[model samples]
Structures are given as C-alpha cells and as structure tokens.
Target: MQPWFVYRKCSNRSCDMCIYFLVLFASVCLQVQIKREKALDITSEHLIKAMADQMANEGWRELGYVYLSIDDCWTKKQRDPNGRLEPDPDRFPSGIKALADYVHSRGLKLGIYSDMGNYTCGGYPGTTLDTIKTDAETFSSWEVDMLKFDGCYSNDTEKAIGYPKMSSALNATGRQILYSCSWPAYEGGLPPKVNYTQLGNICNMWRNYGDIQDSWASVLDIIKWYAVNQDVLQPTAGPGHWNDPDMLITGDFGLSYEQSKAQLAIWAILAAPLIMSNDLRTISQEAKDLLQNRLLIYINQDSLGIQGRQIMKVDCLGVWKRELVNGQYAIAVINMGDDGLPRPFTTSLGLLNVTQCPVGYKLYDVFDRNYLGLFNSETTFNLKINPSGVVMLFIQPASVVNHMKRHGSYFG
Candidate 1:
C-alpha cells in the first residue's frame, strides 16, 4: 500500500491543473464526515450525547469532533405510518430529531445505522428495495449527517443493487449526507464484483474487511490481512475512499497498553479512518494517551493519502513504512510475537521502500515523542520491542528537518 507523492504549488503553466484539483477533491470530498461508531450493543441517546460532548472537548488531534454514530439497536422493531423507521422510544426518549438538534448544538453531526435487507444485523427492520428512498428521506429530515449502510441478510447481487441504490437515493434527497458502504466486505474485498472506483464515487469510506473486535488477536488479524493484500487493496484507498480496518479499539478494555499502541501505530501508518469505538466517558487515561497521540494523529490525517505497507516481516517482527506529504516518511517497527520479554528488532533506512530519501534521516519517536538524533542508511537501528508492541517513527531527510527547525516548524 506504500505510494510516493509529489505535491507542491504548481508554478509551471503547462502542468495539468486537473491533478492538483483531484488531490484537493480527495482531501475535501473524501473526508467529509467526522465519524465515531457507538459502542456496540450499548448504544442509547444519553450515551451518544455524552460521547459526542467528550469528542468535542477531549484533546483529539487534528479533527477535534466526530459525528456521533449509532450502530445498531437504536431503531424500533418496525417502521411507522409513513414507512419511516422509528427509534426506540425508551432508548431515545427525545427521539433522533431532538438528539440530532442537541448534537448539532455542539457542532457535531449525528449518524444512524441501517442494513439493506429485511432485518438489520441487530434484527431491527432494515430498508429493502421498497423502502430505501423513503428511509434516506427520513434520515435527512431528521438531520442525519451520515449513513452506515451494512449488508447482513442480503446476497452479493442484492448488495450490488441495493448499496448503490441507497447512495443514489441519498443523493436525491438534496442533502450532502456521507454514505459509508459495506458492499466490498460482503463480497470478500475486491475481485470482479467490488469496484473500488465506483465505491469511491459513492462512499466517503467503505469497509473491505471483517469487524475488529477488542483483542490483540483481532488486531493482528487485520494487520495480517493488510500485509497479505496491501498491493491489491492499498491503491484502492485514498482521501474519500478508505479500506476501513474498522474502528479504533484503543480506549476499550480488550487490549493492553502496549498492544493498544501497536493498533494505533498500524492504523495511522495505513492512513485509516480514525473512528473510535470505545466509550469515551469511561476510558482510562492510558488509553486516552494512546488515542490522542499527536504524532500518530498527524500520520493518519496526512493529505498524502497513501497507506503504509510492511516492507519486511520475519518471525512476527516487521517494518512498515509510509511516505509523508512533506517528502518524508512514517515508519513502524512491529513485534507481533509472544516473546516473554523485550525482543531486539532492527533495520536501516536503505531497507525501506522509498528511494527518494538518501542515507541519513532525522527521526521522531511517535510513542516517546522525542527526537532520535540521526539515523543513516548504514546505521543499524535496534529497538527492544515488547510483546505485541510497536515502535512508530516519523522520519525525514536530515536536510528537511534542519530546514524545519530553522523555520520553527516540524515535519509530520
């Protein structure tokens, strides 16, 4: 998934303005929503309200707030008279519209979930070919800013028809609602059926993998999938269309502090969406530290829009690298093994994928938040990686870093 970029203010009159416009388009159109998935099975109006407020106030890097998303179980068992879906009255006492107003009051958008089948994955009534348009209208009327269209009880052909149909229906509403399609994942992620180009035209982001549970095993599973399939899948992701490895589970209970940092590093290296899936109000300070890591956030939000890849992996130890927008790189050294103690892992600049950066690179340790002098091509840097842990480095050519210091700025 590693790709290089050459972005600068175009001075040549002969340059194709279309290329710059496409980059700007991806930057604006693709990242239209600030999304956060509600904690699974425990979603409610009060919970969403609290999390939304927290997202706005917490020291979240770059994108300060998020669209509060209700996953499943928010809707009633069936629809109302106008064929519009209804929220569970008890769970959503003020209703979705009123809750939406409250969220908007804080400058946050509200997102709702749905399936393109007879029933939602949570067994709530989902929209079919018959009700998709009406449902889209209903969401717009209620001030929903994002729609996560899932596939559960539908076949592949049904998915191809219904998912895009829903996108069209949403567009017809004359509301700029962000559409997140789950079609590629249902088709096992990209072959003859999953068209990445069309998905980009339709969705702000699409899931092309399994849901991430809160466990080291789940984290490794996703990392492995990306590592094995990045060549085919990485090019498919950019600003507006992302290969979602699912939500960030850092602030949740399943992963240890070290393991949580690993997940964050890998996700940021991949430039994946930063949709949190944990309960913000109840998260620990350690988890919050990982979630709000400034360096990691900068990497994920880089406009370069290139996902990183594992350049080398041996015996569960690996190195992942991504090119930065400012002609630098973000490198991650991962230790996925079950070593009882710190394992010595090492690599050098020459081994990394990109050929632009010559020899010596000034590096910043993302987790430690400190400068690591200078690492040249011949220098074999060694890191004692803990079990299931990662060491993330933001790397830059020494000349560029020195220039930044002279100008009182730092490379991302």
Candidate 2:
C-alpha cells in the first residue's frame, strides 16, 4: 500500500507508523441492542383489584402474571381419569378461564402454577404423567399469560424432560405465555454442559433462588448472592429473559420503613422484577409510597440491565453504584450494619471510568433532589448514612469543566 489511513492522531512521540487498529477494532465489534422488560409477581390471595388499580395509577403499564397464583391449594387429590388438569373450585370459584378473563379486563395478565413432577410444592396434582401438550393447551385456553413451573417432585431425569416438554407444548399453542423455571440456583440442574442459554431463549425468566422470606436479613442475603452471580447468568437475561429474584417484600411484611426503603433501593439497583407480594388493598401509606417510587423504578427499568455492584465498603457503610447507558451513573450509599454515629462516605467517579485521575465530574443526589458541589481532579462527595438507610445519587458530566467557570454548580 502506498499510505495507511490514520483516523486518530498518534500520541507517542517515538512512533512514526500510521496505526489503524482502533478503527478496525471498533468496526469488528458490533453493538447488540437489548430491550428491557418490567414485571411484577402477585399471589392469588392478594387483592387483585387493588393491585391492578395501584399499578395503573402509578403508570406501570404491564401487570405481570396476575393470579394469587395457586401455590398448592388449587387442585384436588389427583387429576381426572381423562388426564385433564383439575382446579379447586373452592379457591378459584369462577374457574380458571373466568379468572383469567377478569384479570385481562383489568389490563393484567394471568399466570398459573404447575410442577414437572407428580405433585406441586403444596402437594397438588401436576402434569408429570399427563400429556404436556394437553396441559399447555389447557393453560392457553384459559388465557394464561405466564406459567411458573416447579421442580419439587421432579428427579434429575424429569427436570431435563419436564422443561422441554412444557416448552414445546406452550409453543405449540401459538400463544405468547411467559415460561418461568423455578429451579433453585444451588441445584445441579443448570450448567454450561446443559446449555442454559438455549433454555433462556425459551423462558421469559427463571428463578435462581428459593422463596424470599419477609425479613431484612433474608432480603440482603439474596441480594448479595445475586450481585456475586450476575456475571455468570448475564447471558440468560435481557428483554424477554431475566434472572428472577422472586417477589418484592416492600409493602407491609413487618419490615421497618427504613428497611423497606433499603429493600426497594437494592432491588431497583439489582434490576430485579418488581413483583409485589403484599396485600395491596390494605397496605399503609408508607408502604404504598415505598412501592410507588417512580425514580427508583426508572432505574430498574433502564434499557441496560446492568446491575449495580458494591464499590466500596466501610464496615457497615456500604456504597454500591451502576453505570447507566445514557452516560450517567446511579450510586447508592447504604448503611447496612449497626447504628452508631452517622458515618460519612464518598464515591469517586474515577472508579466508574467517567473521568481520569486528573479530571473530575459533577453529581446530583437524585433521592434528596440536591446538588453536590464539584471537586477538582475527582468527583467526590460526603453523605451521612444511618443504619439501614441509603443516599442515592446520579452523576453527570461536569458543566463547569466545559470552559465556563461562572456556572456555580449544575447538579441540582
């Protein structure tokens, strides 16, 4: 070649050769566009009307899988002799189809429960010995929007057979229903050899943990595990498919107001599905406010499903942060340990690659709706965080750094 095209100026003084590696690298790596999906899991026992009303009022368009889902009581001692799935009339008085229609009328989708084994978790009859096609067709006929498949009585072989069988049946119906695999994460079902990526393609979301109890400790423990395991399951999460973290415990489950806020903040940061498990009809004002925090909800619904991670830890003062796709940063300064003197914590923008060591950025406290003044060479701020409380921030590019020293601070 006579001459090489150079797109970027050479920075090294000793180099004279025209380099095009950066351009070539950029051209080779294609950016994959991903869509994000918001979901809420509700039990059948929850007040369906109230949940629908609240979701509609709060601007939540999608009412994920609405059925106080028949955890175990929605079945008889056994299936019918004709191999048809039976419904407990006592619980579902209007029948499954009528219930689905009612949910649909309220602009919500109905999700039901099933097991791959002979019985469900609550000992109800499952589709183990029955035809998968028929069971799936039944659900479709009932207008079921989602299915939560349990592996309670399923053996290792059944686990392999049950999921695929149900998937094929559901697909055959030509109805779009979200399929959720409820296999515990610690279980031996998921592995690289089993090709979980393919499974993810078939199911909308899969549960990696058991039922999340209603306690701060339980919630924190599950969140911690998800933070550590997110990278491992990243390939299986996106618009249609997500790594489910179970339902939310924010509304009146015996958690303190501070604890509920912490839970909501953490769940939003994790990008977990926003499923409410409490009785929405009788919830308190504080509980409703915690659930209806739109600012935090937006973070969870960000197109990029990048979960936040703990950036720095100062004993009980834990700082977690995430980078949004819009060149913004979401930070959570939390105090999870014992309540001592209010501790001050700072998060550096340098850690998020937004700026180099010699440059700094500006941050806006989204929660408090206040501006944190800029710092030179690094975006650093201090906040007094109490136990089980959090201070959330959104970091943006420094407006003052762009040649105008007159602008005091644009964070507000």
Candidate 3:
C-alpha cells in the first residue's frame, strides 16, 4: 500500500517504515481536538469582555465551549510598519495579547478573525496569501487559541491555494490553535470543488453556508438549508471537525423569546457549535436563560457528536432527532409558523425513525426541565409547540445505572 506521507528521502528502510506507520496512525486517530466555537463580531474590548464573562461564568463553559472567537474588524485598517497585523489601538487599549490574557483568565480561549484576501469583510487588514505565514505567526505570538479565517475579497484560485496554505502555516506554528475557515462556504458548501475529507484533515470547523444575521429569517434560512443538505453535511461533522451554522443569535434582537428558543433548540439538535454572538451585558434575562440552557448544551456537547436531521416536517411542524452518547436521543419538535398561537403536534417512535424505540425511555423536557414520563414504541407523544418555538427533549433510555425502567406509561 502507498504511504500517507509526502515524498521524502528515507535515511534507511526502517526509518521509512517507521515514518509510514506514524503517518498512518495520525491519519487514523489524531483528531484536531477542536469542536466548539463562540464567534464574536468586531467590537470594543468591554463588549468582548462581557461575552467572555457570559460564556465562561454564565454556565456555557461546562457545555464544552472551547473558544470565544472574535470575528472581522478587530484589526486596524492597515498592517503596522513591521508588517504585522495590529489591533485597533483605541478599541483595544491593552492590545490583542492583553485581551487574550483576559479571556484566558476567565477560563476561556480567545479567537481572532482574518481573511484570505487583501481586506477583511469589515475592510480591515487581512492575511492575504503574501502574509499567510506571517499572520499565522502573529496569531500564535498573540497566544490566540483559534482563528476564524474568512474568504473575503479573493478569487477562487487564491482561496483554494491560500486556505490550505494558511492551515499548514498554522500547524507549523507548534501552538495548539484551532482553525475555522469560510472556504467551503465560499465554494458554495458542496460538490464539485468542496472536498469534505480534505477539509476534515485541514480545518477544525468550517462555515458551510451564509453568515447569520440577528433575525429569525436568517436562522430559518440556515435551518432549511441544513435540513435539505444534511445528507452531505452531517457525515462530515464530529469531534475535531464541524459544519458551522454561523454564530448563535439567541440573545440578540430580531427574534422573539420563543423564536430564540427555537434557534437554540435546533442548534443543539444539529450538534452545531454553540458560538453565541450577542450583546451579553445588555441581553434580556429570558434570552440569557435560553442561551445557557443546560439540557440543550448537554445535547450539543454529546460525545456521540451526531448532527441531527429533519426526519419529519409537515407544514410548520417538524421533528429533528440526534442520537446521543448515552444511547438516548435529543429530539426537537419545532413549529415554523408565526400564527400567534400554540399548535398541537404528535409523533411516534416509528415516525421519529426510532424503529423499535423501547418502552423504558424516560422522556425529559429540556425546556421545562421536567419529566414527561416513560414511553413505549407504540406511545403517542404529543406536544403543544408555540409559534416559531421548539420543544427539545432528551429521551433517555432506562439504564441499569439509573434504574428508570417501568415498562409502561408513567405520566406526571
């Protein structure tokens, strides 16, 4: 069999064989160890501090969030005289390293943004092909924990070359930095030129679609796109690699309380990254509660790491189910309508594609944090879904450890 390594002169046959096995081992088992991203937009230091505080202290860290990322516009309009990217002196009074230190002090990692072209999306300096390695070193020097590399202002050829080159440069830094790319998104998210396998090997997580504005319409569009294309998207996400659905707008305006819940619940079900991007300090208490929902976070962080799919959708009612690490399932009953009234919906084990869903599952309501009681395969589960809301549940199978077995219906 051909070796996985690039051609290199072997010192000896044993050395060559050793190199081959090591490369093979890494190819098979070394995942990037990056699975979450909480992307922030260009903002002042105070706002970034607030987001870091919320993510670290307000119950999101325990949910497996690893990086608190800053998106575009963190830098000045031009590189410094030394050809190094510099943070806006006024916005970041303490500099990028200081901000990174603050985030680290809060028990969180810091992420900064860059573009593969001449300028970032916000018209700030970028890490174009000429500066890719320098930019990588700059981020590493700043002790940045992650990078959200955008594909703005570049031709297809430039992106195809620059994106991978940047990834290589990052690896060469010898620092444990996660790479989040917009390459696949610029390539239109699939097929012809999009190579998911290579992406998994290169990028830790990648934006697969458009940016999410702070609105329900944008959220709905992303959901719809993922639902239809999950066949190609789901298999590509797990552990170190993921399909980013952009930042979470849970605590932001443009979505009602119920609509925010839908966004959070659907994101959890999709096993997507929990990168929240909102004004955390000024966010409503209700939005904060939903954004930091423990059950939803647990489902999102489930080690099974399976992205959910829209198994059933009729009109505005839909069901999305994600297999969890515990042999249970995280399911979301979503109402897509805005009729200003609650809608009653129903589904069974078969409809959920659970096939032979056992009778001992203790379906717990994730939103209400109450037991919905045990159910059987033939059980008819009903939910009163609010308009543009979701009822996410964790149907935990009765285990020998929990001893929740009661072979029949057990309603509250």
Candidate 4:
C-alpha cells in the first residue's frame, strides 16, 4: 500500500526559495507516513528500535546497512529558547540522544537530518548561518554519527557559504560525522554548476538528483539520469565520497518483485548508499530476501570503490559495469521497458572493454547465487531479463575464483 502524503505551507522567513522545500516535503512525507502506520504514536522512538532490532537480528546490519537515519520532521516546530534543536515532545519524548545511544548499542550508527536554512523542508526548526556552530555541537553531543544536511529555504550563494561552513563546524566538533550534502543536487549535479572536488572535501556523500518516489517510474527516472550523466558522476564517486541517488524504495508499494531486485542490483552496481526508506516490520519476504542479498552487498562494499558506468543501451535493455578490487567486476544488465515480458539479449565482455584474463573470468549471478561458469572476453552471454528487472553478475578472475572456492568463501 502507498503512504499518505503531507503538504506543509512554507512558513519560514526565508525568501521564495522555500517553495522548493515544500515540494520536497510532500515527497518525503510519503516514506514517513509509511513508517508511522507501522508504529503509530511511538513512531519515532519505537520505529528506530524496530529498525535497529531488525537490522541486527535479520542479518541486514552485518550485510553493511548500518546507519538508521531519522529524516525531517523529527525536530520540534520551534527551537528551544536557548536556540538548540529539540526532538518533538509528542513524537520523541526520550529525545534524539537516547535514540542515538540505542542505535550505537546495537552496533549501528545514527544519522539525523536538518536544513541549511531558516527551517527544514518539513517546517521543523533548521540551522541558520548564525546557529550552525550550536547545531553542530548539539549533534555531536548527542553522538550523532552522521548528518544529512539538506537544502531548503535558502539560495545558491547562501548554500555555497553555509555548506562549507557547516563542514568546518562539524570537523571542529571532533566527532566523525558522515556529512551527506544536498548542495549539488540543488545545483544540477554537474561541473561548473557543481564543484565535486569541493563537495568531496566536505561531504562523505551527496544527493545528485530528485528524491526517489515509491514507484517503478521513479526508479527508472533516477537510473536514466545517472546513465545520462555517468561520465560526470562516475569519476567523482569513490571510497569516502559517494554519489547518492536517494533511498531504496524496494518492498514499498511502487515496485514489483522484479523491479525491487532490479533496484537493489543497480544501486549496488552504482556504488550508491543502500539506505532503505520502507517499513521493516511489514516488508514482504521477497523484498526482505533481496535486501539481505550477501553477494550484492559484498559487491557494493568492494574496496575498489569505483562507480559503475553504463556501457550500452538498446531499446529496453542497458548494461553497466563497475571495476572491483582484485581485478573483478560487477556487470548489470537491466530491462527498463514495460512490454510485460522478459527480453532476451546477448553481449560479450570484449564489447564491455574487459580485456582477456590469463584464465577466463567466472560469471556468478548475484541474485540467483549460482555460478554461470567461466567465459573469455569473446564469449557471448545470452541473458533473458524481466521487464523492469535486472541480471547482475560478478566477473571474477579464475585465480581468485579457485582460491575462494578452496577456502569456501564465494562472495569474498
């Protein structure tokens, strides 16, 4: 089922730039309402616990989905008289510090959200230029491991100054907060318009596109944008600095089972952050299984950290490749069509610019969890991909494949 959407009128003193935040507010509310239905009045605190317990017990945390982020609207509508951000009394009576402690106790990290303007997108209190230091210290004191600093109710010049200043403020706190910036997404996520080198210096990851909605169309739109801008986005992404395509809406109302798998596969291939924005308590078993896919998660967390690039696109089918540690690669063939049938296609590694290995590479299916055998660069891989689905393979050199099999470690 889809979540109810909320629309809050822009009530901040900032200029007309707030209209942009109102739109983002309405979209993010969809995901928030879904979680609310799962936990009712104890939504904020109990929901975090539920997510933490699930992540720990269900093997998701071990698979590298560590951070449980609290998004907009978690704060009070107005700051305390001392100009400090406070958790909403009605929603989070135990407060954000207690929540962060609980998350850390579960061997997980906590991420909180705020804006770089007078108010958050959800109309909650935000950090202005004068209050940046206070908010940064508050987050550190609460033991917040990450901060998703959003762009709302502010202009370009304010963003340019505020983003860097906030980074400095965060560093001064002497806490290791993973800064997720929205500055570039507001500036069109490209060079001249977006200074990625500056972003890399400030943010650990940055959103590069519109917020993802819970639908196959929304997923397709994001993938298409990344493909179109691959040359620009790919090089800028690496170990600590990543190009976020927004959250994983898998197991939510919008995508089919195939589409859910496709989303997880492609997100891993892109080396994007695997932040799930769905209700964990009610997710379907199929969706749960896909979220916990070990091979896919391993490929995503590869030490190489190179972002994948789209190699070919033919009508409904598109192929992408990411270089991995130990000379391996992750290749994804996605079908983004709606013809209601799986499309059969063929391709070779040579066409993907993969040079011949001393011994042919072994093709292992990430979702199916089966080895498709060794193939040289000239060998054609015939594949049938479901509409709005994907076929993800890990290409490992024979030497490493033999060593992994010998040690009984397949996804290593």
Candidate 5:
C-alpha cells in the first residue's frame, strides 16, 4: 500500500505546529450576547491579551500553541461610517492592530473570526464579495496571522464563490495569513459536496463536521464522522492543510478525565488541529496536563502527517493507527462503551499491519509514559480500556533504531 503523502514540515517561523487555542473567552462573550449582558467585565482586548500572556507564562507557547484566536462577537453591531469593519469600542478600546502587535510581541500569532455572509453568526457585519477585498486588506494591515471564516447567514452559492474569493483576496495582500475555512462543514463535508482537492489548494485547515459541543456524545460523533470519512479526508491533509474536527473541548466542562485523554489522543492520530476551546484562566491541572502532553503533541505534529485510520472497530472497541517519520507508528485503542467498566481487548502486531519487525518492535505507552517491552508480528497484547477512555501507544521497530544508531543519526 502506498503511504499517503499529505504532510510536509512547515518551514515558516510560526507555522511549525500551528497549534492554537480558540479561547473559550470568545465562547463566554457569545453566551453573554445571547443573555443580553452588555457590560461584561472581560473586554475583548483583555481576554485575548490574557490568553496570550497565559500561553507565554504557562509554557504553552514553547509547545507550539502560538495562535491565539478570537471567535465571533468581537466587532460592533454596525460597521464604521466608512464601511470598514471596526472593533467594538467598548470591548476593544486598543483596537485590533494594537492587540495583534501585543500578541506578536509575545511571539504568538493572532487569529480573528469573520463570516462570508451579510452578517456574522452573532449578527455582526459579515464580509460579502463586495467587501472581501477590503476585509482581507484590513486583516493583513492589522497583521492578523489567521482567519477563521465561518458559514452563517449565507447560502451554498455564496459560500462556493466567497470562500475561494476570500482566499485570493487574502493572498493579494502579500501577507501569509492562514485561511481556516468552514466551507466543507457547511457543504455536508462529503466528497460530492466538498471538493477535497480544491480545499487543499486553498485552505490551511477546514472544519469538516458540526461544531463540537461539550459532551462525550459530541466527541464520539466527530470521531465517528472522521473515522468513516478518513479515506477522503486523510488524503487531502498534509503539512499546510488539515481536516479540523472543530475545537478541543477537553479541558472544558462535559468531559471526564479519561474522555479528555481520548479526545487528545484521537485528535493526534488524526493529525487534526489542537485548538482548545477552554478557559485557560481556570482550567484544572489535570485537564491542563492533557492539553500540554508533549508526546501526543509530537505525534499530532509529526512531519509524516499521515492521518490515522480506523484499523478495526468491533462493538465498544475501536482501534486507530497513524504512520510517523523514522518508521515509527502510533496506535490508539478507544473504548466507546458506557457500561462503567474497562473492556478487555486482544490484538497482535500482524493484525495492526506490521508486516515486519526484524528485531521486534519496542512499544511505549504514551499515556502512561511506560515501556511495554518488545513484541513481534504474532505477539499478542491485551488491553483493558476504560469505558469512554483511550490507550495510545507508540511503536518503534528495534531494527530501524539500530540502523539509525549505526548510521550515527538520532532515532529517539
């Protein structure tokens, strides 16, 4: 079988991992808008700046969590007198340019939100074809590093035209702003409706499913959708492009500890973007550890960039595997049962598609950070996966490690 060559290493300064956080601060403001709270204490500038500061202070910046994104409701309900979009004076007194400057000073990139329709999802002014050039230029001028263009209040025709138009418009500005599109998600996220080739040509990443709500069921739904659509989605994802399953709500409400690990592990296997939609200010320590797990992040950002596939699924057990550079592989076994007990599962290297391991395969339990000993093609391994949980392992062939060491190249 030919290995899917969708991933390339990002050589640009900030695009290395492109790990980002769609701050839950934006979610809170959206809730405030729905509740009609006009005078919230956390201003847009404060919220975004605080997130950037936390990334810097908490070591998240070093982990490649560099893009700090501001979602909807950051703008005034009305455009300025000149028709250019303006930040809400009360919420963003310092203005977006200044905020972008601040984020950049911390070595972080700033991502802003907008819609390709008459109005944003929150009913703020959106960018139409007429305003696409102006909005793109404005964002570039502000040094915005990323744009999360949403699909709201727009029909299919408008999206088809506007999405690529905006991509071209952003390119015309001469700034390298990452385009995060919601096109596929709105167009059923399937082959007939979504042109994966065209999407890869234009977008840096795309949402391919419904918004991930804060629930175990929501996570499972996304996992199932991506797993079922892996063949189509995997081939299009690589260094510059990715299939976004929406935000990681792991650190937020509605997930248990094991469930959080499952979300993180599977997202890594899928090579999906690790955009956290949780409140960084008050996230629990356990949740924070999972979010900042370096081993998982390494797998997710592997240069090989091969999106994992569901090797097998039977009853409550689902297995996934992603190929990595240096002949390494990642395997994730998830228990989707809700029976409140660990499900015992058994499998071997041969079943996992390991055709050959000349000196046996050394397995490392990434979640527990333990060495699980060496095994071969027929070596059987047993796992007791907790309900609503996952166990992820990294497989490295001993022969490859020995060969690399003989050649004086570091394999670890």
Candidate 6:
C-alpha cells in the first residue's frame, strides 16, 4: 500500500475521511514547501540573536525562516578534503550548524550564501562550475533553510543556465530549501525583464535590480522603476512567491528617522519583502519603530498582495494607491520637492470609484488613526506631506463610518 493509504487508515473513519485525508496530505505538502520559501535575509551573524528577539517582541509571529545570509567573504577559497564548503573560521568558529541551531531555537530559520561562478563576489569559492549537488546536500545536512545564489563570477556564457541548475540541485536534496537568484538585471545587457513567473517556478525570489545602497536616490529610483513594471510581475507574486526588490535600509544607515520612515513607507506600498539590512544588534528605538510600523507593514501583508501603482504624478508631487482585500483603499500622497516642511496635497476619492456609487465615502488617516468625517461625492483632503514623505489614508464605506460613530466608545 502507498504511504498515504496507511495515513488514511490511522484517521477516524467518516464518510468524508478519504477526502479529508487527501486534503490533509496536500496541505502538509504545501506547508513543507512554504516553510522552505518563507525567509528574511541577514548579512551579519553577529546580530542573529538580537534580530530574532526584536522580531518576536514586535509580535512578528510568522518569521519562520530567518536567513543568516552571508553576503560575501564568509567562505574560504577552497573546499575541505571532504568536499564541503568551508566557513571562515575567524568569523564562524563554532561551525555553521551551531549557528543554524541557535537561530532555530529562537524560532527562526537559517540561510547561507554561495555563488554560481568559481569564486564568490568577495573572491571566496563558489559552488558553480563545481559539485553543485554535493554543495546542496551539504547545506541540507547543515540544516540550511535558504540559499542566496549570487551570479558574481558566473561567465556571461553560463549565466542563463546557472541559476536553474543550482535550483534543480537544491530541489534534489529533498530538504525543501529556498533559492534566491541574485543576478543583477541591469548588467549583461539584458532587457527590462523580471521573469518572476519562470523564476518563481523554481526559486522563491530573485533580485530584480542591482545592490540597493543607503541613499534616497537609490531607493526612489528603484521604487519608480518597479511601479511602472509591477503589472508584469503581478501574476508571479502571491503567498508563496515574491519579487524581492532587495533588503530594507532602515536601521543603521546614515539616513535620518524621517528618511528611514519614507523608505519603509514606499517599500510597504510596493509590497516589497521586508528583509532588514542594518546591524540589528544595536538598532535604535526610532529605527525599530520605523521598521515595525504596524500600519505600513499591514499594507504590505494585505491578503490581496497587490503591489501599489502610481495613479497620478505632477513634476514633484505624486499619488500612489493600492486596494486591500477587504474592499478598502490605501492611498499615499508623495512630495518629491526639496522643501523640508510638510506641503499640502490632494487626490479625488471618486477617481478610485471605490464605492458602487462613488459617493458617501469616509476616510481614516492610517498613520494618525484619526477618522476624517464624510466628504463631498468627489472626496478630497489637503494632506501635509513632508519632502519625499507621504500622507497615507484608508478609505472605507460609509457603513463602517456610521458603525464607528455609533460605537465610538466601544472602538475606543
């Protein structure tokens, strides 16, 4: 008998037993797959404990996979005689598996790094052009949950096939590990292609752009570019698959609190993955608040998983919007001008045609948690958005508004 047949026999016999068994089996399979893919990437292993602690304290319940992703320089130039990738003893003297266990004990997952070429981006040895299967198995034995596969030294002649080959090797291990393709799209004369569907078929997420630096221009350019091409990637992103725009620059960068908030806000609107990139061990309270802005993060994690798009643009002023699964609207009014003070901006709620009649709409400022009373059929509000900052609001049906008014004390 098949393995599933025995599992079915062990369950209580009911008319729906067979169907329930099949569903249960499928659900288990899917959970295993998703467990492999869920992840957050980190570069500094030194901050592993602190990162895990912060995530837990902030009520981040499902950070199942905490990838200790070694960006570069975490390996030696040669594998050991046993054919396993050797870690830089100076940095990880306790061995990789010990670190993986530490993360696992904290209720997080672990990940590692390798390149497709003979050497890593930091000139360490890569698994590419070598024993790919063996390298994958080594990671599996070490309890790695994710792998960031970079295209650092991969030759142009081999780049196209290298990623898929590594993915196949990882899958062969039957260990259910996530593969992150880090091929910089801008290089190699490639088209403006983010083939998320094809990539998602094998890997969890792929870097669609180059390295994201800690600069406002870097963040702004990436967001603008992604907004224009988001439709092309919509089909590929969902609960299990995502389009990674790279890591969040929230904590220890030179950015001010306002700038960090702006970065987090735009990224959340874009539905970008929230893998943080700063030294979390000593992150400041302001930085932590910026990273854990519940309202903004909720927009990113909305069930709809729809990336926000630019609905309107004036030279230095813009409006971007996304729809939540609960029939609410998330709108952001952005000011790109140089002025430091907040400037007034407005957008028509009717243009969104949110309600069946495009009338009787009530708005709530998501940031301030204050409800703005009813407005005209073509609802508009003068929002004060700081330079490169946003005024985000959620529009709800008038019924919700009435309910809130009737039970104001209850809601409070």
Top candidate by lDDT: 5
Instruction: Give the lDDT of residue 62 in candidate 5.
Output: 74
Ranking by TM-score: 5, 4, 1, 3, 6, 2
lDDT of 6 by residue, 344-407 (tens): 7655666655555345666776556577877645656677887777677766666554645563
Model 5, position 272, has a per-residue lDDT of: 84
TM-scores vs. true structure, each candidate: 0.86, 0.76, 0.84, 0.89, 0.91, 0.79
Q: Count the backbone clashes (under 3 Å) in each candidate.
A: 2, 5, 1, 0, 3, 1
212-282 in candidate 5: lDDT tens per residue? 88999999999988888888888888777888888888778899999999999999898888888877889
Best by TM-score: 5
Lowest lDDT sum, 10 consecutive residues, model 4, at 17-26
TM-score of 3: 0.84
Better of 2 and 4 by lDDT: 4
lDDT of 2 by residue, 352-380 (tens): 45663244556665555566766554545
| Per-candidate local distance difference test | 0.72, 0.59, 0.72, 0.78, 0.81, 0.61
Indicate the TM-score of model 2.
0.76
Q: Deviation in angstroms for 275 in model 5? A: 0.3
Error at 324, model 3, angstroms: 1.0
Model 2 residue 129 distance off true place after TM-score fit, in angstroms: 5.6
- The alpha-carbon lDDT assigned to residue 197 of candidate 2 equals 66
lDDT of the structure predicted as candidate 2: 0.59
Candidate 6 stretches greater than 4 Å from native: 1-46, 57-68, 184-194, 231-236, 339-341, 357-362, 374-377, 398-412
The stretch of ten residues in a row with the least summed lDDT in candidate 5 is 1-10
Candidate 1: pairs in clash: 30-240, 34-67
